[model samples]
Target chain A: MFFRLTFSSIRHYAFRFSLAVLGLAISVASLVYFLSFGEGARRLIRRSVEDFNLQLLVLPPAQSLTVQPLLPRSLADSIRSLGVGKVYSILRLPYTAGFPPRAMGVVFGRDFSSSLRFISRYEVVRGRDLRDSTVREAVVGEALAKALGWDVGDTLTVGTGRYIVVGVVKAGSPMVDNAVIVPLNLLMEDMGTDRLLAVAVAPPPGKTEEVLSLLKREFPGYTIQTSEELVKLAKSFVALGDAIRFGLSSIALFVTAVLLFAIMAITVQERRWEFAVLRALGATRWFIFRLILAQALTVSFVGWLFGASLGWGLAEVTSRVMVEKFGLDLVEVSPSILILALLVSLGVGLVGSLFPALSAVRMDVREGLGR
Target chain B: MSRLVAESLRKTYGRKAKTVAVDGFSYTFEPGRSYAIVGPSGSGKTTLLYLLSGIEVPDSGKVLYGDTDLTAMGEDARSRFRARYFSFVFQQFHLIPYLNAYENVSVGLYLKTGKTDHGRAVSLLRSLGIEDPNRKPYEYSGGEQQRIAIARALITEPRVIFADEPTGNLDSKNSEMIFRILTGLASEGRTVIIATHDLALAEMCDVVLRLRDGKLVGS
Candidate 1:
């Protein structure tokens, strides 16, 4: 009977109830979308960093951005002797490539035979991998290939020498995906430099800190960084994204709460006589309070269910577009996020109904009936 | 027999002018009898009914129900007392707008006993000539609505039924029908008190008390 009365009252004011539900649904959806975007971006960055297999990069100390720093090619052998995993020397230089020669692109010179064994994240999506052929060949990242409109058998000028595109690759990381990769010996001869810019060493599992500490001690004048440090540095650059997401979500929740509060207050006022009738029929104040709260829970629960499903669908589509257009894996709807959204909606319901329920219970029966 | 006794009951309303609605009024009502409190407008007939029914406390007096002082009890205790020992029928009928005839009649039973007897509610509605138990109060005529209110009062089987102008909105035929029902309750050994302006209805009761200017003029 209690539930019937409550539901009947809700049906009596269906328009207002729907308005409240819609408002709550939109708020919850926004919260889920924003939080999922933040979580997805973080996961993408972490996965990209982890794909390097705890790799460490050794750079020259006090290297200036305007001047390319060079390290001895023997540094790779020295690092390999420290009981670490495979070590590869890389020489990176800015070079204009493509038919029209696009600007702001780097050419990474690597040992073609050992590069695949050392870099865990590299994967060829098109054409063939680099081989020890007499012809000069290059593997461009997916982004760089798209930008230059280059495919297999296509040739591009790199520092007065042309190399055929051997493979289109996906490096997972945006920075790496934008670069072109070629054989180290060919680039070194073309640049007239035997020195390298950096040495990338994949440390054995559970030996990252040991390798980093050993390399720092072995070469006091060099700068070394493990994958963990690089990942932390990358995350620090996107801290603002997280803060903005949190702020927007908080504002959405606040607006939901306010809208719910206003709707509940109006409902209570409209039903003042009904509450008085219940009181006159020997209903306790607590019973009236519970009835009001029950109405709020019903509205909130339905709204949350609808909003969560809609948000999940939207997030999936958004993630797909991001991956295709921006090459970013941003928007994953996890179970934890769904549960948090549910809890937040229920909390909003509870808080929104509090004042209205109190007012209903405190009404003077005679006055309400008289009105 | 159950009896209601009021001694020097005084009730006043408003703070600035302080009009006395009931002043130094006293009465003793016994079971198995029908009583009518008759008065003109603003003469405190409804106020006296409210005092005796424990709907409102007296300003400066006591109302005793078989030796239990109703005014001394807390609000919840007074409510429980009303649910157990008394039922009320107002002039407005006061039927819940959303509830049908049967649900409205069974509502008091649920409140008092924490359980509803659907069979009893159906029988009462049938006896009162209400065929459709699903029709809400708004769908019923004024007389039919009053009959539903009476059924609600009777469903509790209280020792006393306090009715404040129960037939005020009814036609002549309906008024006579309502008087017959109140007289029938009195014959069944339940006390029935009604406040009204109809002299004919008051005459049908076993006793009549007239009030003028918040004081008992005659009995």
Candidate 2:
């Protein structure tokens, strides 16, 4: 009978009920979408960083850009003899613009053959690495190719120098698709490398923190970023996503709550007479209140459907856009975030019904009937 | 057996103004009897019924169900008492607009007894001369709806039935039909109390009380 009463009331004023449902859906779906995209991007970024063995790297400082230090020339020479297995030299430069073979983007250079196991996030989809003897050979990512249109056997220009495209690898990471790699010296000096850039160190298993401490002690001016920190930087409130996600979700939670509250208050007023009648007909004050609450739940549940869809849509759009912009491989959905959104919707419904329930409870059966 | 009782009932609205809606009134009703309280608008007849049924608390009085003092009881206890021992037939019916006649009649039984014996609910409807128990209250005639309300009042086997203007919305024939149902409950050892201006039904009740202000006038 509680359910029946709720259902009947909804049927009696369907247009109002639908309005309430639509309002709730927008809030719930949008919230879920926002949270999911952030989560998805987190995973994709982590996977990309891990493929290149960046997950466990220990940095010099919490704010360092040197993801791998053992890959640098002078640093490699010392680290190779410091009881560490192999120290492959790697360099990375991050500015607004770089050479054209990398085409005005972040630049990375390292010994590809010697450090392939440690620093090779790329897959060599088409050609070989720049060999020790090859003076005019380099490799470009698919995205960089799409941007500048160069393939195998094509001549590429970088930092006022030219090189033949010797190899290609399809690395699905955002960093790889937007990067250009060359032999360490060729990237910095021989290929007219304008910048020395930061270096990555792939220490043997369990020795990462030890070698990282040594590097930090040796070079006090430079910063070292671990794989976990790098991944966190790429996905978190680092720079880009904070402004958008935080701004939208905050606004959504606020505006949606107000709208929901208003709708419930109006509904309570319209049904005041009915509530009085129920109370007159042997329904307790609590019974009348529960009826109103049940009504709100039904309406809010409908609203959550739309809200969840909108949320999922936002995530899908976010992941796709990020992938296109920076080659991020974020997932389409986030289950945890979806659950949170539904729970929020349920809460909204319960909270919104409070005043309405009170209104029902406070009615005077005799005053309402006017007898 | 006493059906419903009220003693020294006093109800005041707000503090300073303290409009006494029902003041120092007392009444006792017997089982197997029908009675009506007749008065003009603003009289306290309906208020008295609400108090006796345990729906509202009297400020300084006691409502008794057999020996239970309802006014001193908790709100939940009052609600349970009403659900088990009484049925209300309001002037406006209070039938859930979404539910059909059968559903409405079965509600009292469902809540108090937690049973959905549709056969019993339907059989009660049939006895009331309901044309189609499956139809919503709005679809039935005024009299058929009153009949449905009577069925609802009876379905729970309540010891007392309170009707506020039981025939207010019905024609003469429909009014008489409702009157017959109330009398039938009375004859079956149930108390049937109605508040109304209809003299014909008022004449049929065992005792007819009158209310001038909040106090009762002589029968």
Give the Cα lDDT of each candidate.
0.81, 0.72
The most accurate candidate by DockQ is 2
lDDT tens digits, residue span A231-282, model 2: 6667655336734864687576667667767877887776676666555555
Question: Lowest-lDDT window of 10 residues in candidate 1 chain A?
Answer: A61-70
lDDT score for residue B147 of model 2: 84
Across residues A252-308, which tens digit of lDDT does each residue of candidate 1 receive?
778888988999999899888777766666676787899999999888988899889
Model 1, TM vs. native: 0.78
What TM-score does each model's chain B reach against the true chain B?
A: 0.97, 0.96
Candidates' DockQ values? 0.40, 0.54
TM-scores of all predicted structures: 0.78, 0.87
Clashes of each: 0, 20
Q: Which portions of model 2 show Cα errors greater than 4 Å?
A: A55-62, A65-73, A93-107, A112-116, A120-122, A127-135, A142-150, A229-244, A317-332, A369-371
Q: Residue B208's C-alpha lDDT in candidate 1?
A: 95
